[model samples]
Target: MSVSNTTDFTNPSTFILLGIPGLETAHVWLSIPFCTMYIIAILGNITILFIVKRERSLHEPMYYFLCMLAITDVVLSTSTLPKTLSIFWFNSRGINFNACLTQMFFIHCFLAVESGIFVAMAFDRYVAICNPLRHSTILTSHVVASIGLAVLLRGCILLLPHPFLARQLPYCRTNVIPLLYCEFIAVVKLSCGDIRISSYYGLFVSLLKNCLDLFFITMSYTQILRAIFRLPTKDARLKTFGTCTSHLCVILVFYIPALFSALAQRFGQNIPFHFHILFANMCLLVPPTLNPIIYGVKTKPIRDRMLWLFTHKRT
Candidate 1:
């Protein structure tokens, strides 16, 4: 659907989302898995929140950061999955321009927040393992609150420009976004006007959000590994590293798929459109779906508490 350059055009009042592009026939079937994942993500994160809040023993700094992560996961998945499911089930694909921008804002803002939460989690583990004696003192209630404020502000401030820049463009080309949700890049690329600024800005934000956070998390874990190796005995070293296993697993599941999806969206021109769309949806869904399960299985306290909760409920 290409528009002629000579055609006089105005900003589209509504954009049509072509969910998963080349897979329209399978959309009904695909909705089955997507709906299932959304249910799991919502239930799992909410259960994590409940357990953390109810179990006094899980009220430490690590669990507090986990609560933040779980909350972010809920927002992040919620921002996209419902609309995606709608597109699959009911063919509800038209999104008003303002609503599209709002969705894009929430998606990117919470994504950045999620990245920051991972960094915070890494720091919590570092303090607990590398400087165990002063961990509580370093990460006081006030300090934790400050970190959360900084993270939220950073995401809000940095991503606030995206929609404005997008709005400034003359979207005369086409209003059909070949995505399940209103992705910032996909929406902006529909504009006939110059999009270099938007593209560059998106790249800059991605680097700052993902790369910089990855750097800090890497450094924190590097120090943690060194400290773990310095412990007296094999059992002690394993015990220290055990505390970080859940965080490490969550980070891997969150970052790897996310980075791959971003890169494929930007650079993988030869990739099939439906594959990209499917992978993108998976990238978003997998983290929230897996985070709680990973933590529950890897972290003894959480696992024990979850078991107790279920047992108590059954009784």
Candidate 2:
């Protein structure tokens, strides 16, 4: 609460991100795993995208949604990891204020977009299973394009104010952010003066994006389940339900860690600070890492294509 009175905010405008404090000696060891995970996420998503792009059979609403998800995963992870890797590898922990804001913006924006894509995917599944006859007409190319545009615009518009609001604060306090990246909350916490507006808006935006997205996703899945159960034949039921397994796995990986990370920040004050930081990092990393694996393994078509891609290359 004791902020410095004389430090000029505009003159020396850089924030130092202390990535995993007290683990300085272990940074090299830590970087290995972090670097490995980043590679896997990037390669996996890119592979998914390549397969989705090349295969004509995947030119459907469901696969289109998966493409959106893959793109978001790549951007979200890339936005944070480069700077994070710089910190661990080269000890370049200083980030310019503007650069920090940009990072925070993209990080949250991509996260919002990813969440929106999940909802879109859920709706796609609902239509595909519950109303199979109308599925093609319901989620046509135009509709999919509109959904993609809407998702991007929604994330950008909703998250536009966050960085600017944080920027308006007089940062006379220590410019050190205690996180692995330039997170909105971590940056806001460093600012001087009343930040109630920033904090409240942050909470509101989080609830608005994640909570609403999760709610709609859950509702869509509920209907999907109902529709699947009503099917008379076991084969019909299995085939219909089977299509959703990949998406369901993706939802669990994304939402569970994300919810826990959010809760850890909001209410886990009694918990260890390091635990919260690690959880937040995991929230960002785990989904990107696991999503491709989940889809590739559970979705038979994708798995077959991936295998063919490798085998044909070897031949």
Error of 2 at 34 (Å): 0.8
lDDT of 1 by residue, 239-295 (tens): 888888889999999999988887897799999989998998898889999999999
- State the TM-score for model 1: 0.96
Instruction: Encode model 2's per-residue lDDT on 135-219: one tens digit a residue.
Output: 9998999999999999999999999998899888878767888898888888888777788999999999999998899899989
Name the regions of candidate 1 deviating beyond 4 angstroms.
1-8
- Give the per-residue Cα lDDT of candidate 1 at 43: 97
Best by TM-score: 1
RMSD of 2: 2.6
Cα error, candidate 1, residue 144 (Å): 0.7
Clashing pairs in 1: none
Each prediction's TM-score against the native? 0.96, 0.95
Q: Give the TM-score of candidate 2.
A: 0.95
List the lowest-lDDT window of 10 residues for candidate 2. 1-10
Q: Please list the residue runs of candidate 2 whose C-alpha ends up more than 4 Å from where it truly belongs after superposition.
A: 1-12
